[model samples]
Target: MSDLWLFSFMDDELREKIKIQSEQTKAVVYSKRTCLRHNFLIATSKSYTENSILAYVDNTEMRSAVKDIQVYHMGTDILVKWQINEVPCKSDTFRVQLLDYKYQQFAETQAKDTSTVLFNNTSPEGIYHVRISWDVYSTVRNLYTHAVGLENVNHGVPAVPHVTDLGNARARVRWTTNPHCTPDLIHVHFREPSSIGLLKVIPGTDETTVITGMKQCIQYAIQLGFSYTTGKEYLSDPAYMTFLSDGTFHNAPKLSFDQNGSLLVQWLLRPGCIVNQTVVTVETNDQPAKEYNVTGDQPLARLNDLEPCAFHTVYVTIQYKNGNVERTNSSEIHSFTKEIGLTKIKTYIVDDVLLAHWESTQNCQALGYRVDLMNPTTGQTKAYLTGEMKYRVSIGECVKSCQLLVSAISVDTMVPVTTLIDVRPERVPAQPRPPFVRRDGPALFVWWTEPNLDLTIQSYKLFVNDSKKMIRDFEVKQPRRSILLNNIEENVVYSLNLRAINESGESQPSLSVQYKWNG
Candidate 1:
């Protein structure tokens, strides 16, 4: 008959013990063990229990633990693989989870036979944590947890190295890699005249690697090596480094006009980058572009005899000994040259507005013109800027005689080229002829004629008085020569007068006429 028996296991290294019960004629026990040196198993019958060391069978295989983990970067995705040293049993299950920088799980999945898991859309700039767990004999056990970033994993190809020419048969190379990479060693390889040469450098705060003893004005091949933390060495694609300068200029060329209105070109060069020659170009709307070549030592060039008041664009370019050419960024400038004085300027009066116009005799390409009208009597001036040929201002009765100045202005240069003018109305309407009066029904009529046609007559003024003071007044617009007087009393004496009006002022009153109203 089979009897119930008790089995116990003890880990001497960890000093931990566990017990299980079984009922069988031939007792067998698989006790879990930790990674330690010594472990003992004890079996007991109904009467007594026996203690002995587990010598033949290894129980540590049943205990699951994370062994090796490999992480790879795939752009915005991360791939993780966890490998276990021991063969997995049919009942083994695996769980994979992706966590954020704060250890919050965003995605999770479980499988029975998968060692690799992929998380997509995890941008390269993000910090992510990965967790893996497996079931060992119905017990959940965590395998590994790791933090991944761009600097941590050799996800893709390493960044390309940048080489700069430092002149005098010397060159400088610079590059950067993932910060967490912690490369075992950095190697720079080049083929020398007789054999292959390698330079070993340690990655740290220093970023620049300088290589000397190279031929000037020649090209050479270069390669870099990096050893991953997993003890695997990686080599980068071959890159070319040349000692000849490539006309690398950091600052754009500056273009300006001198005090004498001449075109001046100025530029600057980086400390180590040298060029064989520089070319300056000038272009205009009415003419083709012109180029000027200057030696590399000369930083400035002057161009004289440019068209007056012309719009021009100037730019600079540099060339290397190897025929490589490069233009400076934002090196071009567009501007207008200074202008000459305006000519054939004339001023006149139209109603209440003062009209001033000029002739573009010099064909100046100016942005516009400025007209200024100053009242000498009141000491007040009004200014106007316009692109048209003519400018107008209201003078009316406020300004009888004023001074005018017309100027040509360039948008690039605010300097004015002006011509002075004295503004005065050519003539005012002459005095009107003597007036006559007529009676029709109960109203009296007063009439007059304008004797001068040389000046424009704005209106006609009529005045009536009853022997002592003015009684009624009327203003008749142009083309009307008569006005009718109402409310006439019987047998009363009245005096009538008329005047002509123009832009200048009212003309002297016409000789008075005597009249009488009879009922």
Candidate 2:
């Protein structure tokens, strides 16, 4: 028979041998054995409440203690068996590299009761595996699975675009996003030319990478993609790096200070590459002696008036890989002399909002101003004292004759950004006139001409009196650009009127049209 035997709670020396931390805690006890090969097995009888199984060590020289390794679920009471494979007689390192075996399960009948079964066994191919099964009512388990542990695994693919360029001598070397990227952690690695190459690390989601002062023949490649063609050599490796290209371009961008104190600049970069003003270089437009490095946030090489005509300009060049330099320049935008007198407001209908925009005429270009718009009915302030930035207002309606003011930079020399003024109803258009025609019959439709403007004449309004006691009015959708209002009532005498609508208010009624029922 098997050398192991099963036992239950009794009043032998067992109580003194096993230690329990609490009443609900399990007792752990082990007996030393020095036989050919020996082991310990402890299990529960039925469904035990605080269920736990412990592996006992009898052979002291073996690596056996595993802490907090829970082996069985408390849901079902399981009896587990322990076994020791043939002890390795070699070095400790060879013993530590030991592998695990597997087992299997089958339906086992004890008596009239049918229950579950579990065991450690082997397949026909001799690989180890475990199995678990349950019968009708009574199931027993010799639960010690010899499941084999994993032996092989590997890491994921690395990132992209190893080689890059930044322009006046910089290259934008962009790569793929790290899979381990988090809100605070962006994991990327780079190498420069020395043994370490020119390694630099930048954080955040901005994808394009820039390499500056790149040597002419120094090749650079990154670990990305499966097939990268490096001349005659075919690269099937994803992280292959190479330093050769078919051709190169030297078209550095050209930007100069414009009359508006803005940089008139241009350059060519690889499509989808990004550029940012993290580094800045400045040179004066007329004087070569006036040159220096300007901070990214600071404007202009030096501050002065007049040779400047209101602003300053500094030339900058960005360099890319393949030894190309693209030039773009920095612009110092100065305030303009105000020539703004009358501000023109036009309404544009968009998909979901209304927009009010204006264009500066003559000298108002570099100058700034404030625009105030309010509700006519509520007299509540909407947009007040803003910059000369033109944009569509979130506020949908428009009002007439509002207060607006502007302080000219030519006059004040103090306000760089502008002031207000007041405009009235006389500045806007009169309401549209209603259409007129005597209806000779139902099919006899006549067209009336109206001014082509941005005025609201939603539709035609017709008034008729069938008797002295009852007067009826009909409102129909306005006519198409063709001018005639169609589908009107036949043989009816109509007294027509018109009105214009805006945010301020509707215009007064126009001259009426008298129609006689000739039908």
247-306: candidate 1 lDDT, tens digit per residue: 243667787877655678887754445578888887776698888888656779988756
Candidate 1 pairs with clashing backbones: 151-178
> Would you estimate the TM-scores of all the predictions?
0.34, 0.24
- Per-residue alpha-carbon lDDT of candidate 2 for residues 1-519, written as tens digits (9 for 90 to 100): 112222222212122222233333453444432321222323343222224353332222343211111111111221111233344311111001112243333222121121212212211232322222212111211212232432211112223455544334455555554332211222333333443333434445475555455434344443322111111111112332322222254434354545444444443444432333322344444554343333433223332222423344444554344343445534454334434444345444332233445644235443444445555556765543435545444333334434432332334552322334333444333656665554434533444456766554554444444323345545555554223444455455556555544443344566677665553
Q: State model 2's lDDT.
A: 0.37
lDDT of 2 at 330: 43
| Clash count for each candidate, listed in order shown | 1, 54
Number of the predicted model whose lDDT against the real structure is largest: 1
Q: How close is candidate 1 to the true structure, as a TM-score?
A: 0.34
The Cα RMSD of model 2 versus the native structure comes to 23.5
